[model samples]
Target: MQAVEPGGVSPYRFLLVAARLGSVRRRSQDVDMIKAQRVEAADSALIDPAGSEWRSAPSTRLSLEPTPLISQPSAYVQAKWETIDYGAIGNVSVQALHNDGGIFFRLQWNDATENDDIRDTDQFTDAAAVLFPVKEDAPLTSMGSPDEPVNAWYWRPDMETPFSVTSEGTSTTIRTIDPNLRGNGAHTGGAWAVVIGRALQSAGDGYVQLTAGEEGKVAFAVWQGGNDERAGLKAVTLEWQPLELEA
Candidate 1:
């Protein structure tokens, strides 16, 4: 019955795993080092990991991340602020995409109107005749190309934002329209839906996992008619923090 070595553990030691682990690996020189490590780790014998000890760490000792600053528009979010404002084309209008080629959307900040009495409005209206060819550089109002045809597509302001896009066979998913429409009914079908998304997702140009968001992109492009596709947006801006929702 006496299987244990005289210098080793006794049968009673089986009750504890530490005892079963054999003597703690201890070197005479390491003894103080181990004790110090244990002191730093446990802080106190009464505050072991398994034990519930609410030892408060010093503010200086604790890892404290700096308050982040979001000044620029993010990929996942777009915010904008404007004191002076005027659309390149008079009256609220929609840009009609009449071709299959790509397109660009743009925005410009006109400081000239900064002194003018600017009326901030959530609802902007456009006439039946859309403000065709919105993309422009420099002064921006010059327009891209006039010859491009106008096609009818679906659009809703402050609609649902698209988090993901995929295709199955010949039919392209194109782009999704927002379900919830915001103020001002002008740009509807045959237009592009606008939603809040990250203005600048610096993570990289890869498919971000679809998740809920608060703010979304101003609008999106969709091809309602054949050849008419959601072209690229040129210069939109973000000045204020945007309320958005994610997919």
Candidate 2:
């Protein structure tokens, strides 16, 4: 498989500004937690974002904001993007489910342009990711410190499957292929629906292991390819949203 550099803005670098701003904090108690409903064994059909099974799952709408231009890792990167507006995809709808096999997330967002292919340097493929902290106190805004790593399930339309990304602080992202990581995406009617999933338990080292009846934290990021949003220059959730998995 061809290895693609984490693009749009360097993916993990987007959080550097948050670290500098000292916004890192433990998960909050008052934030509304999104529950991952339990379901029977999921089939391939359930992996489709538009599948009927999703109708039965609870949904949450997450508002997104542009990663600050001040967060770009380098002056050149900052300069190149200073004149343009990115992160135009302001919000996304999320639904989640877990079975005996794994946990899955369905994300849908409005995008007038379907940018699935990149044929030139100026082109980019739309992308999205779901992030979870490996440790309870890990900061979602900084993508975790070396002592508190973060796990990410990342998807881009051009890839045959999603990528498993782990990071120990900003600019420390590592990407690897995980056989169990699955993704399906479809674009229609001025919108895109995508599903990304993984086994309920950790696939291996560097992966977050999850359990039922437990509470955790999650975050999200989206790159609007049509707007040249990539890497650290995308829309993101600044805070870690609470997540609960039903027993």
Candidate 3:
């Protein structure tokens, strides 16, 4: 299959490609919006992916596809991945909950291999991220434009904590260690469950401030270390999904 160049196709062309390749397991129309359940302030399990509190929140399964090869940072990456099949992870289960303190997202996916060790040059840890647009009209495929940015709460099994990432278009990502961002992950059986949490409001610039009783947009990305997936070589939601928070 020929890889579609970024500028040659629409932002949502990945869906068509996946459909033609028979890789898309489900359509986005099945789950139109992600409703964040309202929880009490004292619920300590909000940040815990394995906690029982997640049982009360609803889950939305999203079908994912490989990011466009042309969107990669360099020619080396494009050439290296031209004939290779990467981003095989096809689906991810997502749940959201919020309280007066913060908003939490739980992402669950299946993986036969648990890659937590990153000691060698070829080794990389499994990772996931939840992205929100800084502006209402920000583009999802290119990770937003110069005037419009996107904020990402990134988590990996090897790190002690998650990272606050901001991006303006492809290859323009900036990662920061934010004390406010917290994450917990656990691998049980053949699947990985991860929870990333942050305050509803922003602590500083480059942070996407989420408000209650309003609607926003969110996207997801996953990197399978065993598949040598990193940077733009990961599975992602092609379009932004609507997110509605309870009042």
Reference-based lDDT, each prediction: 0.20, 0.81, 0.83
lDDT of 3 by residue, 152-171 (tens): 99999999989899999988
Model 3: residues >4 Å from true position, as ranges? 1-31, 41-43
What TM-score goes with each of the models?
Answer: 0.16, 0.86, 0.88
Task: Write the number of the candidate with greater lDDT, choosing between 1 and 2.
Answer: 2
lDDT agreement of model 2 with the native: 0.81
Q: Pick the candidate with the highest lDDT.
A: 3
Ranking, lDDT, top scorer first: 3, 2, 1
Top TM-score hit:
3
Write one digit per residue (lDDT tens) for candidate 1, span 58-159: 101101111111211243322331221112221111111101111111111111111111133432222111111111111111112232211112232223
Superposed by TM-score, candidate 2 places the C-alpha of residue 66 at a distance from the truth, in angstroms, of 0.8
Q: Which is the better candidate, 1 or 3, if ranked by lDDT?
A: 3
Q: Estimate candidate 1's RMSD in Å.
A: 29.8
The regions of model 1 sitting more than 4 angstroms off are 1-158, 172-199, 202-247
TM-score quality measure for candidate 2:
0.86
For model 2 the local lDDT of residue 224 reads 91
Q: Candidate 2 residues 1-247, lDDT tens each?
A: 1011234333234355445757564443313477998888565866888788898888888767677677677799889977777777777888889885788989999988899989898999999999999987887666788999999999999999899999988778899898889999999999999999888886667898889888898988888998777888788776788899999
- Candidate 2's C-alpha runs over 4 A off are 1-31
